[model samples]
Target: MSTGDGVDEVAEFAALLTELKERTDRSYGSLARRLGMNTSTLHRYCAGEAVPQDFAPVERLAEFSGATPEERLELHRRWLRAVAVRQAARPRTATTTEPEAAVAEAVLPEAAVARTAEPEAPPAEAGRADAAEAAGADSGGEVGSGGGPARRWYRRRRTALLAAVTCALLATLGTLSALPADRSPSASSPWPSSSADTSGSAPARTTAPAAPRPSPTASPNRSSSPSPTPGGDSPTPRTPEPSTSGGTAPGDATVPLTWTADSQAWALGCGHDYVVAQPPARVPPPPAAQDAGPWAAAQGAVHGRETVVEITVQGRSTTAVVLTALRVRVTGRTDPAPGNVYAMDQGCGGSISPRHFAVDLDRDRPIARPVAGNDTGTPIPAVRMPYRVSSTDPEVLLVTARTQGCDCSWYLELDWSSEGRTGTVRVDDHGRPFRTRSIAGLPRYMYDTSARRWTPYQ
Candidate 1:
């Protein structure tokens, strides 16, 4: 081992792996699972054992580790060095009593190192060569000249370009799937095209917006409603009243309405079949789907990907609320949202074998994932609320209600994400996931008909 002039053979090898894991922000467990190896065994590999000659799992692990493009190439280089050393004969470094020497003793056991090479060459010598190469480089950023800022920037750009191309290919496939069953024009249809929004030439069909599910409400029958045709029957209590372009009320039109169980609330899953209204806080006024005044209008654009929808009731209504289901898309990336995508595998309340569901921030439905931090592995309880418009196209906030633990708090944005095509979840200072300073509303509580009780806190 040498000082500034040379790099320590053992230290450099270990540091490379450590940095790779850090930059990828991947857990050893996740890496192992992706590689189809026992998690404990994978941890041992990450601990600096030589890779087995069997490289299938290793290759896949490299793929999903979320490394930048440059990092992938580096991984390949490091792996090649590891294999080269495995094929060679290596001597065990001496264990010594001296403090500095003791530091050189690796906690990793030699037996764990993958022995893939012919025994003629020694691994110790191969490792020595690798170290010499690394130290000779001016910086750790580049392979030939040492990794410098310019080199690092070039590597990053290359990686991003590759990712963009990959995303584009996937998008093209997804675009095809987004289209309707048939491309034929129907006399009653307006938007004559799917995958494209050019429909001004289509027929004049009354397009109604989606209806929102209220939090908890005394209006027990509000969930379900019969679809209404404008010129038909007498006015009913729960018709889907549509707002005209001019915001004018209809005097001669009598709309027939009916209530049906809210399909949107049940979107959460079999058990969570309810919306974010967990227990209703305040009974909302009529038309929970109204555009309302200027307050409800969107102001600007968000950086990442996002989706917004509106709902309206045909008859008299006061309050407006939103229910959401959230999901993110960044191929090969794990959601930054905390708490494992809100899987209630055990069943909501207490049903056995309920269907698995997640909070897909990408959709206009109601489910959310809760997450914990590095120090705490326990996931937080969270759900998706309606995406509000304070700014334009913002990454939605996936709010979790931690009724207890770490003291009662209002909402935990375990992970806030947008649809910008960038798939990473961003965390802020304190290493805590991103959070907003003041969430809009106060805690509103209500009763759950299924639970037959009231939630204790917000």
Candidate 2:
């Protein structure tokens, strides 16, 4: 593959895998027979001549080698990187034309064209011909034309434009490279988690027993050269510690909220992208709002950004964990309050379970609430909901609800202000309610508990 660096990342991983296999002292024939595949296929994969699209075999090999949890994680990360390199090397198009050819055909002068018209031309002459054609095109004159001074001027301008565009394209690519690449929750690991996630959280660290040191006889099949341990330099993602929660008054107690998810979820914002995972590490709570003038002070709500975890449950029991972060805020509260807000969505049966918690810093306790719809006499469970505390306005917490098993759902306006001062109101959902949006400019509507009718939302 013609990666500019000319490094065969796939081969590197293959070598690493080879080292691991040798440590197990299992011959290719024995391994292949166990995996029920051709021996050459395994060799090809180990030799870096080919990569396995499905990772089952690789995972199995890791298991056979008795790789430790960290080592296994490293192996997976390396495999992913190798796959990425291989895919990137694949040609995107069946055919491509040289840019010079197009320029030459479009702008070459007749004399120059005739001289370079041979079926084949030397590299040096071809280069000169391309330059001459580019010069001709810059003049803004027909291929056969002559605008001596004008052509020179145009050529200079054209060259400048090309240089500027090249710079711009390079800059854009660099920025894109800085962005976190998206990977499905199932692809990286089975679980999802976040510390303060808004979208899917990043992969969490896994622990496994370390493999025993191979015997001297087992070392014979391995190459003499040392193999680099994968992800050795990378920081291992740590499980977030559980946050503490419990108080009622501003300084009486501070409670930390507990967040859980049956599967992985995503949280994207604040320049950090992640997937939710479990046993999350604690993060700093949101800082209190700055004291500006009275108007500025009342302008936006103070928000907390922290890492959180997501747990994958099987019939009420957690099976795996992932980690991510989230941004939470409480409206109409800004005086360095000892609490933070957290929200979670979990898969419950055929629908979704929505929950949000407020951690009281002073008392160290959490206040949990399940946000549901009361459309029918009985509450209809929601499948998913999008919500957020207002930034500029300190009194609005916007949320929209949607049901999973059925088509029943609506919008809710929550007053996530101070304790003893918060409230919730059901409003017309504008039909499609799964989407999260602000109700600030929406048509005035509110649920009339007594009349049970939509009325102006004063």
Candidate 3:
């Protein structure tokens, strides 16, 4: 399999498929026969020329090759990534041409409109129109011998009407343009006034006082007190600043950073261990690591003793934002969740050298502590904040929060500053606090790869 920098998912998927087929010592024709597909079709899939719409064939092939559970899981992940890329790359058919065509017809001259409308004409009628035009041109601008005078008269009338329409349209546009920028056109005007507010409310001022500077030590949950203006009057209501090309305005309530949190991140080189309330028999077999989030939810599972959340953060604009700190706010604490613990993978070993932080949820004041690589034993220097990120440069932080004393419900607050504005962004599991329950002394189970069943962990 392709590894390390600049890996193409589609190519990696195809490489794995080719590797599996080669391990089985199977030829394209032989595998195709078994897969109920043509040799060429199978070859295309293995060569990365095509991705299968359904995963059934790929799964069957893996089983036929006697792939280990981990290998199968990796294969599935690669396939999913490849399929997503393919779907996103597919071209969307244009379905919005009619509105543009109407606009073109509204502004074009009559002759230009007629020419533009020709493509919509019936084939036979369009052919005849072209022939008539050719004949008129060849005959020195005459329609025919007897009808030349009548045609000339009709053409003159048509030209005069077109000129009058053009002049009237231009005058209307000029009148609209001459109107004051702040004034809305009357209701009787031809075009709807975009700036007019139909609601019978007080007109909003065009400008407002600048917002007060945010306190650096302000609590994330505490609302800031409004600052008084110099005239001792209540500060004018702040207007929302227009979004800048870099991102949302700094004073806006919305954070300028965009982030994705993966709650199923690998912990200490092992797959996620979820503490589900269901019994081993009632709960389904553990899914692959990538699908763990949904599976854990369906089983009503919380993270085991340690929950490693991988968060990828980047600024929405080109402006560099420095991530100052990550703070943990505990919402609740209780006894360990009562249930069985399900481990998604058996004993597995790997190295994770990403920039990571650790949180001790049992502590009175839990703070994210920068940590070195996990499982490798070799200690690397830990780089602590502040880290800079931009639209082009994203940073990934792996946060592992462990609780052995009590179950904890918590979320993270990321403090960031850019340009002279600082703000705090709350990060949680889709608006809900992340829950991690102490799995100590709980019944533990692991999927036995050989038997393909959940078994009690010794």
Candidate closest to the true structure, highest lDDT? 3
State TM-scores per candidate. 0.27, 0.22, 0.45
CA lDDT for candidate 1? 0.31
lDDT of 2 by residue, 387-413 (tens): 211111111111212111211212222
Write the residue-wise lDDT of candidate 1 on 201-227 in tens digits. Answer: 443232233333334532322222233
Question: Per-model C-alpha lDDT, please?
Answer: 0.31, 0.35, 0.64
Cα miss at 260, model 2 (Å)?
48
Candidate with better TM-score, 1 vs 3: 3
Clashes of 3: 0
Instruction: Give the least accurate 10-residue stretch of model 3, judged by summed lDDT.
Output: 221-230
Residue-wise lDDT of candidate 3 within 200-221, one digit each (tens)? 7553322232543545763322
